[model samples]
Target: MRVETVLLKDYTTLGVGGPAKLWTVETPEDLKRATEAPYRILGNGSNLLVSDQGVKERVIRLGGVFQTYDLRGWVGAGALLPLLVKEAAEAGLSGLEGLLGIPAQVGGAVKMNAGTRFGEMADALEAVEVFHGGRFEVFRPEELGFGYRTSRLPEGGIVTRVRLRLKERPKEEIQRRLQEVDQARKGQPKKKSAGCAFKNPPGQSAGRLIDQLGLKGLRVGGAMVSLEHGNFIVNLGNARFEEVMALVRRIQEEVPLELEWEVWA
Candidate 1:
C-alpha cells in the first residue's frame, strides 16, 4: 500500500471534484494500519459528494485482495455491487434485485443501506465485517441498525466485507427478474452521474418533485439536471464540482419555495 495525491474528479462518478490526499490498500493488514490515520474508505464513488476544496483527510481505496468476491459465506466490501448481485442471482439467490441500477461497491452500499423499490441491502445482509482500532469485528444486521439510506456502522469503522444470506430460487426466474430491472434502468438518462443526487422525501419522489418544479434540463456550467430522471445530476463534460453544488442548491431552494416541500441535498 502507498499514499499519493490523486484528483477526485477522475475517481468519482460525477467527474466533478478537486484532488484528494489518497491512499490505496489491499490486505487486511494494510487496512488495519490505514484505519489508524485520519482516513475515509471510498468504494466505487457512487453516492459520494466531494467538496470543491477536496477531501482533506487520507482517502483509502481498496484494491487487489479487498476487491475479491466470495459467495460461499462472505464477500469483499470493495467488490462491485452489480457483480455481487449478479452472482447472487445466478446462484438462485433471492433479494438484491432492486440494486441492479445502483453503481457502488459493497462497502459503500452497506454504509448507505443502498436499495430501491424491491428491497435494500439491509434486507439481505446477515453481518458486516468491519475493521476498527486495529481489530476486525463482525456485526449482525440488528447491531448495525440499518434504515432508509443510512446505517449505524460507527464512524471510523472500516467495512471490509459483508455476509449475506440468500434464498434459493429458480434460476430462470432469477434471470428474468434481473433482466426486468436492467430494462427499467435503460430508460434513465445516459451520462456520467453519481446515481441519485438527493434522497427521496418521505412520501414523494425526488425526481417527480424536480420535474414538477420544471427543473429538468436545468444547467449550471456543464452540470445539468437529467432530463430523463430529475433526481440525477449529470455531467455533460468539463463540469466542475462547484457547478454541481450550485445546481443542487438551486433545486433545493426552488423546490421548497415553489412547492412548499423541503428537499434536502
Candidate 2:
C-alpha cells in the first residue's frame, strides 16, 4: 500500500474539494488491510463531490493487480470503462459500447449501472465479485436489482472484478455504434462536471425540465449550470463544493429533482 495526502479536487472531475489521506492498494490483500478501518473506496472520481472540508476517512484507490484485464470479458474493477469498451470492440465483442465515452472505472459503472438509452452495464454483466465483511462473494445479474442509474450492490462492498457476457460481432459494426454514441454526446458540456446533476423522474426529463425553467448558466461562486446541458453543473476554473451545492439548492427550489451524484463531506 502507498499512502499519500492528496487534494481531493485533483482527483475528482468537478475540481472542487479539500484534502484527504489516500491509500493505493495493489492487491486484494492490500485492499483488505486498507478497508480494515474507516475508509472510502473511490473509482475514477467521475461522479463524486467532496467538500472543501474533506472527510477523515482513508480514501482507497485500486492499482497494480487490480488494473489487469483480458479480452475474454473478465475485467478488474480498477479498469477504465472507455478502455474496456474499446478493447471489447477490437475483440469483435458487442455489448459494452454504451459506456464508450463515460468517464468511469468499470466497477463504478457497474455500481451506478451507467449506460445510454440503448443499454446499461447490467445487460453485459454476467457476474460481479466484491469484497465485504472480510470475504468475497459473486452475484449474477438477476440478483443485482439493476434499474435506472442504480444497482443493489451490497452496502459498503468494494467491487474486485466483473465478468461480462458479450456477443461475437463484426468489429466494424461495433466501431460504428461507438462512433454514433460519440456523436450523440457532443451536446454535453465540455467543462469540468460530474455529468448530470439531477436524476430524471419517471416520465420526465431532468434536463428538459431545467431548460424549461430557464436555469441555464445560473452561477453561484465559480459553479454554474451548464449552458449546453441543463442537467449539468460545470466548474468555471475554481468551483467550491459549497458553490456547487448552492446551485443545486437553487435548482431544487424550482424543480422537484434529486441529486444523481454522490457528496462526501
Candidate 3:
C-alpha cells in the first residue's frame, strides 16, 4: 500500500473538494492493512460530493490485482464499468449493454445498483466475495437486499470480487445495443458534474420535476444546474463543495427528490 496527500477535487467528476490523505491498496495484505485502520472507500470517483473541508479518515482505493477481471466469471471490484460494457459487447455477452455509458467501477456500481432505464446491476449479478469480520465470505443476490440505486453490501465489508450471469447474443447485436444505449444517453450533460444529482423517486422523473419547477440554470456560486439536464449540477470552473450542496438543498426544498450521489460531509 502507498499513501499520498491530494486535493479531493481531482478525484471526483464534479471537480470540487478539498485535501485528503488517500491510500491505494493492492493485494489482500494491503487490504488487510487498510482494514486495520479507519478508511473510506473511493469508488471510481464518480457520483460523489465531498465537502470543501475534506474528510478526516484515510481514503482507500482498490488497485493492482483488484483491477483485473474475467469475462465470464469472477471480476475484480475495481474494474471499470464502461470497460466491462465494451468487453461484454465485444464478447457477444448480453445484459451489460444496458449499463453502457454509466461512469462507475464494478464495486461502486453494485453497491448502488447502478443502471439506466434499460436495467440495473442487480439484473445480471449472481454473487459477491467480500472481506469482513477478519475473514472472506460470499454473499448471494438474495442476501444483498438490492433496491433501486441501493444495496446492502454487509456493514464494514470490502467487496473484493463478484460473479455475473449473462446471456449470449450475437456480438454485432450486443454492439448495436450499446450504440443505442449511448445514443439514449446523449441528453446527459458533458460538463464536469456528478452524473445525476437526485433519484427519480418511484415512477416520477426527478429531472422532469426539477425542470417543471424551473430549477434549471439555477446557480449557487460557481455551481449551477445544467441547462441541458435538470438532474445535473455542473461546476462552472471554480465551484466549491458547499456551493454545490447549496444548490442540492435548494432543489430538495423545491421538490421531494432524494440525492442519487453520495455526500462526504
Candidate 4:
C-alpha cells in the first residue's frame, strides 16, 4: 500500500484538478483494509474530472494484483478495458471489440456500463465481485440495473473482479470489427479531455444539438468546445476546473436543452 498527496490533474485525462489524498492498494486484502477508512474509488482516470478545490475524502486506486486476469474470463477490477479487448480478440473471444478504445478499468466500466453503439459492458458481464461490508460479494448483471452510461450499483462499495461471458469468434473477424470502430472514433478530438461532456438525451445526440447551435470552438479560459466534436470539451493548456464548468454551464443555459454531465467533479 502507498499513501500520498497527489494532484488530481496528474491522474485524470482532463488535466484539471487540485491535490487529493491518494491511497494505492495492490491486493484484495489491502482493499478490504481500506474499506474501513473513508475513501473514494478511482479507476484509470479516463472518465472523471476532479474539482480544482480538491476533495477531502481519501482516494483509493486498485493496482498490482488487481490488474491481473485469467483466460477463463475472470478479470480483476483494475484491468484495462482496451487491453482486455485486445487480449480477448487474440484469444478468439468475441464480445469486447466495440469497446476497443475506451480508456477505462473494468471496475469503472462496470459501474458506468460503458460502451458504444455496438455493445456495452453489461452485454458481456456475467457478474461483479465487489469488496463490501468488510467482505467480498458477487452480484449478477440483473442486480446492477445497467442502463445507458449508468448503473444502479450501490454506493460505498469497491468492485474487485468481473466475470464476462464471451463467445468464440475468428480473430481476423474481431480485428476487422475493431478497425471499423476505431475509424468511426476518429472524429473525436485528440486534445486532453474526458471524452464526452454530456449524456445524449434519450435518442437525441447532445453533440448534434451543440453543433447545431454553433457552440463549437467556444472558449472559456483554457477550456474550449472541440471544433471537430461539439460534445467534447478540450483542455487547450493549463485549464482550470472552473473554466470547464463555465463552458458547461454556458452550454446548458444558452442551448435551452437539457444536458447531463458525463464528467464527474
> Once superposed on the true structure, which residue ranges of model 4 sit more than 4 Å away at CA?
256-265
C-alpha positional error of residue 172 in candidate 3 after TM-score superposition, expressed in Å = 2.0
lDDT of 3 by residue, 198-259 (tens): 99988888989999999999999999999999999999899998788889999999987889
- Best-matching candidate per lDDT: 2
lDDT of 1 at 204: 75
Model 3: residue 248 alpha-carbon error in angstroms: 0.7
Encode model 1's per-residue lDDT on 140-233: one tens digit a residue: 9899988888878876787888888788899899888888888877767779888887778788788888898899999999999998998888
lDDT for model 4: 0.86
Pairs of residues at least 3 apart in sequence or in different chains that clash in candidate 1: none
- Model 4, residue 130: distance off in Å is 1.3
**What are the per-residue Cα lDDT tens digits for candidate 2 across 1-265?**
8999999999999898888999999988898899988998788988999999987999999898788887575689999988888888988999998777889998888888888776788998888998889888999988888999999878898888999998999989998998888888789999999888888899898999999999998999999999999999999999998899999999999998989998998
Question: What would you estimate as the lDDT of candidate 3?
Answer: 0.89
Among residues 3 or more apart in sequence or in different chains, the pairs in candidate 3 whose N, CA or C atoms overlap within 3 Å are: none
Candidate 2: C-alpha RMSD to true structure equals 1.0
- What TM-score do all the candidates reach, one by one? 0.92, 0.97, 0.97, 0.96
Model 1 residue 262 distance off true place after TM-score fit, in angstroms: 18
* Model 4 error, position 4 (Å): 1.2
